[model samples]
Target: MRTSDAQTLIVEKNPNPVADSERDALLLNPVFGRVFTDHMVTIEYSRERGWQNGKVRPHAALQLDLATLVLHYAQEIFEGMKAYRLPEGGSTLFRPGANARRFRNSAERLAMAPLPEELFIESVRALVRIDQKWIPGGDGAALYIRPFMIATEAVLGMKPSAEYLYCVVACPVGSYFKVGSPSVTLWISDQYTRAAPGGTGDAKCGGNYAASLAAQAEATREGCDQVVFLDAVERRWVEELGGMNVFFVFDDGSIQTPPLTGTILPGITRDSLIVLARDMGLAVREEPYAIDQWQEDALSGRLREAFACGTAAVVTSIGNVKGRQYNFTVGDGGAGPVTGRLKDALLDIQNGRVEDRHGWLDRL
Candidate 1:
């Protein structure tokens, strides 16, 4: 276990890697999260020793005790990011430091040991360097990076885990949703609330996503591509989608989204778009939007477009919205000009197609 001086991560090459030909085949048109690279990164953490023994090894199954704390208590957090293949023949991570900061915040909220921000970023970069060959080319394709931490302490008592495992894995993935779709329909989840003001709503933890599955399933039954949740208290203000933050474009060229008042996730993509929109001389508002107002505005031509933003799905336009009592379409029910412009601005910066004026990309 020789330590890497540059990043302090120990490197171990895979003994039996997949053939290049086979890897190329898997990279072609791979489904999201289905095809993985050959190597992964892991680091152990303890209350006493802190973080140590970081390693880059072959990807394999994790051996956890039957009574692991995460299995019982669900003290887990994760981040989703991508490594884009540059046109000039290298790879880079998009705003990984932001993800690292979010990961630390989630850890603090969950009472888990927080991995250092530098370690988190380096762990991801190390894996990307080792598995650079697995990065795929083509529109909407990149190496999807998943960095997660789980409570590994084998205790049944209801307390924070004293030990944890941080792991980073990479997978070759295409579009998260159907590719080339003009837009997607969303179902309003009146029966379910994603998170409350006092809960883990703002944290990017596994439990929050676990709690949303039921509502997501309900949306699927209703023939919608995704679910949009309302606030828990009033149940009237629109909050966000099942796994993404939402934005609305009004006819006056102003955009608004739900405020991060302890209930919203404060998405990196959401933050980036806000910055980009402001740079482009557009008004971006962080405030609450009501469901009734949304429907009424769309019908009256005041609401020109609606879209959801996140790391997984990027920026996806909301063409149609439906609830129990009402259904409406925004501006002819297709991707709007504002949505397209924001998506293009984001994608261009991410893929290195334009100047990275904001210094968002971290090249490997």
Candidate 2:
């Protein structure tokens, strides 16, 4: 990778690489998050030096202080994206610049120093370029790239920390929530909310997800795959799943997802899905999808399909939604035709099986 505008830090390769047999076996199942690539990218940010000391180092334990601001106040943000092995033996990152922009936005939201777009993209490219052999090539597998920033300053005050750390880590993996392919169940929780109306929901911070873990546990207990959260205040309108955004497909060939109303994560996959849907000649709507409408339409088959989109899960078919005492099964309580078609099309583009008509793929 070559970049004239920024300085790059290079690290020596890992001497103790994964054994050939062990790596082959891991690629067989390639359970998600089970293993990580040999190396990662890191860059530190401070008020004095800005972004400095960029490096592609071996993946190891970070010596973080116990009194770090991230531990005390949770000033952190993250972005999830992927690298794919192209058909011609090379690799690419899908919408990596978009993720870089989102990473900066999340940093701004948390009052942390934002890394330059070029620097962020360069660091990610450096990692993926060197780790190309580690990128999984099987069906429904991908190189999951997690780029995150954390408040590392060991201050006790409630304000944002002065020192921060940014890093990009990659993992070769399988499906995130495997109930089979893209079909799964979810429970809408009217009890605990995901994001408040004016809260930090739009930012990809750790606390937002940390707050949803309990609800997710509850959803699992109720025989659901994931938990969907309503608005935090009045708890009326639909928001999203803990880690994914929700989408509704109508019988009239229309698609709808909740608007980015400052209380929900504006997912990169959600944006790409909307663009792809429009390319497929579907009338896509970005309006507030209420909870009651889901129940009413699913009962009559007007809501033909329901799905959630994210970097990890790409496109997941939501089978049913159970809100405490109320339960509604969508589209025969399984993956609908529309959902399957969209998921297949999206995956084809991601995996280089279909033409990236929307210019979504970034070739390495």
Candidate 3:
């Protein structure tokens, strides 16, 4: 259906909502991606009817057929975003339009029906408005919103499904990583590659993440927090982390990230930082970064800092790197000055502590 038609969505409140006291207790220390809100948004699509039956309903399990296309073929895509409780006692979203566009791109790549950008934004807004109370007001805490689409047709064919389901759910969350060190260590994987040329690497689909589990486990076994993957072709050029994009700060007062060449997900957070860094008078360059060069620069004091950016983590400093053959530290094995500055700048804009000159905030 058209976006205008989606404006008149049906509302169905949850009958057994969480109690205030219980919810408050949960919010006091809401773990990331665990405690969910009360309601969820859903919209269905079919070849004949298109998108219809848009509604906000109670969060519950879906009864799908055993032969569902998505269950077998993995025709699914999703987006990650957050709703922040502003300092002035209101709510806002950070560049949700960008997320909408990326969601459409991902849907197209997966051969699924693309939901209108307005419909995607409106669905997220509707759910956040209904469950606004679930938003945490503590430091570094906000409501995490997840929007996804899946093929729901009851068939086992190798083609795209004729039916689809689009859904949005929210949960209160704190830091994605534990609050211990100001920087995180990464393990580079030479054995597994994240994406190859002309693959689904640019799409934010479930399959890309599923393919990284083995590498991620290898990182964990190596006593590291996260895994950094390289390009599949050369296995030398740095691509990105499992779920986030990577950036390197050179000693020459410039910033560099791997170019978006259909082998890396175009992250909204990464885009924001590029603008913000430029605003701070730092030259930002999108180019190929070799893993060997990364280690060489780090050890030779040419690379000053490095960080990973995404909707969930925001900006996290990468202190050290460990590979099968080489080991090195980034700028004294701690959060560098540039990394801290960039993190604070971005957070200030997101949490409403500074002026949003770029008009990235959408109030609700």
Top-scoring candidate (TM-score)? 3
For each candidate, the alpha-carbon lDDT, in order, equals 0.92, 0.85, 0.93
lDDT of 2 by residue, 235-312 (tens): 778899989999999899899999999989989888988887887788999998778888999998899899988999
**Candidates' TM-scores?**
0.98, 0.96, 0.99
Task: List runs of model 1 lying over 4 Å from the truth.
Answer: 1-6
Going through the candidates in the order shown, the clash numbers are 0, 0, 0
Residue 353 deviation, candidate 1, in Å? 0.9
* Candidate 1: RMSD to truth: 1.7
> Where in model 3 is the C-alpha error above 4 Å?
1-3
Q: Residue 256 deviation, candidate 1, in Å?
A: 0.5
Top candidate (lDDT): 3
Angstrom error of the Cα, residue 151, model 3: value is 0.4
- Candidate 2 lDDT at 135 equals 89
